[model samples]
Target: MPDSLAAALTGLAFGLSLIVAIGAQNAFVLRTGLRRTHVLPVVAVCALSDAVLILAGVGGLGTLVDRHPAVLTVARVAGAAFLLGYAVVAARRALRPGAVLTAEDGDAAPARVWPVVATCLALTWLNPHVYLDTVVLLGSVAGTHGDARWWFGGGAVLGSLIWFTGLGYGARLLRPLFARPGAWRVLDAAIALVMVAIAASLLLGL
Candidate 1:
């Protein structure tokens, strides 16, 4: 295979590996997807945000980030606080235990667009793990591709788009399972746990 093709494949695999794990952003995306509220905008925000970060990484912003440890530190603090707050909200929803979904009628009125978009942006951008994965690690790896670094970045961006689109759209298939209030409660509880665990890891630097 050509160097470009090889680089692109490597980037795609590496990107998937980094993003496939359950994390704050994934959890938010999953919840939003299940609700079927503003799914397009949310998925777009996530994919586009990843594209920007991946491009920045390939463009050498990773070097600047490496030089400034304080940037990650600040992001870590803010991200942890945000995750904790979100966890509380998820916990509250879990406790309420009345939200249920249907094909014709959603759990409730769909949320306004901008707020959901904003939340998606924050969930994608505020997490320091995103930076570590897209900026530092991906960027560093792309650099090894030399002239093919942009191709590598493009592959990574493609992977992100594919993942988010599939996740957001495919979640509807689970609507039957989520039709029950108990299922929603269980989901919210799990989301709360994920958020709390991620926040704790960020705060404790584990």
Candidate 2:
């Protein structure tokens, strides 16, 4: 295989390794997808955001981030606060007995598009871990590719697109299970726990 192909493959593998984990962003995307609410926009936001970060990293933004510790510190604090707030919302939903998944033509209304978009943006942008993973780690890795770093970044970008698109669109398969109100409660409860745990970790600098 050509060196470019090798670099691209390495980037793809590394990106997947970094992204394919349980986290606040994935939890939100999964919930949104399960609800069948503005899936396209959410997936687009995630993929596009990752693409920008990866490209920026490949362009040497990682060094700047490293030089400025305060940037990540601010992001960490803000992200923790946001995650905690979201956890409260999730906990409330879980406690509400009426929190059921509405049918396609049910009386319940879907969430407003912009709010969901805003939440997606916050989840994507506020998390310091995203920068660490995409910008710092991936950028540092790409640097090893020398002239092929852009190709590596492209591969990482492609991996992100594939993952988010698949995750957002594929969550509907679980719709059958989430059809039950109890299932929704269980999911929301789990989301709440995950969010709180992540927030605690962030706040404690863990």
Candidate 3:
């Protein structure tokens, strides 16, 4: 394959590889999207985080993460714990009866943007798996390229933008369905189940 073609194809694959996995961050994005909540702030934080991590991965930080098995292990355990707590919260919300809905409450126009952005940043950064997957593993893989390092990182960032934007804003089309209180409960319960399953899998390595 030609160099440019090779770079783009490699980038596409790299981006897809880093995504397509279940995680709390993604679930939150989808939830917010369905609820027609804050969109730009959520998408921006997710995209920016992806760019930062991709850059770190391409710039040789992967070596440091690779050498620090203890760090990854600690992060994995901590992430699992966090997920467990979040899962319980989601389950509770799902099972609870919702308050009476009104036009004002369902408007979704009141969604705060900055706080949501901040929350996303914390969630993306705090998870240790982010480092392992984006900075370490993807970085190490990108390092194999002789002259396509930027291509690799760019591809990864593209993946992030696509996924995050899709999750955070794409669900707007389903707003009519998700606007219902019962829909929220159903979504929350589904999120909880997925989170619990992922947390257990991470803890058990199965």
Predicted structure with the largest TM-score when compared to the true one: 2
Worst ten in a row by lDDT for model 1: 98-107
lDDT of 3 at 102: 23
- Candidate 3, overall lDDT? 0.76
Reference-based lDDT, each prediction: 0.87, 0.90, 0.76
Cα-based TM-score, every candidate = 0.95, 0.96, 0.85
**Candidate 1 TM-score over all chains jointly:** 0.95
From the highest lDDT down, the ranking of the candidates is 2, 1, 3
- Flag regions of model 1 displaced more than 4 Å: 99-108
Backbone clash tally for model 1? 0
Q: What is the lDDT for 125 in model 3?
A: 75
Local error of candidate 1 at 98, Å? 3.5
Please list the residue runs of candidate 2 whose C-alpha ends up more than 4 Å from where it truly belongs after superposition: 102-108
lDDT of 2 at 113: 92
- Candidate 2 per-residue lDDT, tens place, 1-206, comes to 99999999999989999999899999999988888888999999999999999999999999999999899999999999999999999999899877555434222578899999999999889999999989999999999999999999999999999899889889889888776788888988999999999889888983
Residue 143 shift from truth in candidate 1, angstroms? 0.6
Instruction: Rank candidates, TM-score, best first.
Output: 2, 1, 3
Candidate 1: C-alpha lDDT? 0.87
Candidate 1 on 91-128: residue-level lDDT in tens? 99888855444433564688799988887888888899
Sliding window of 10 residues with minimal summed lDDT for model 3: 99-108
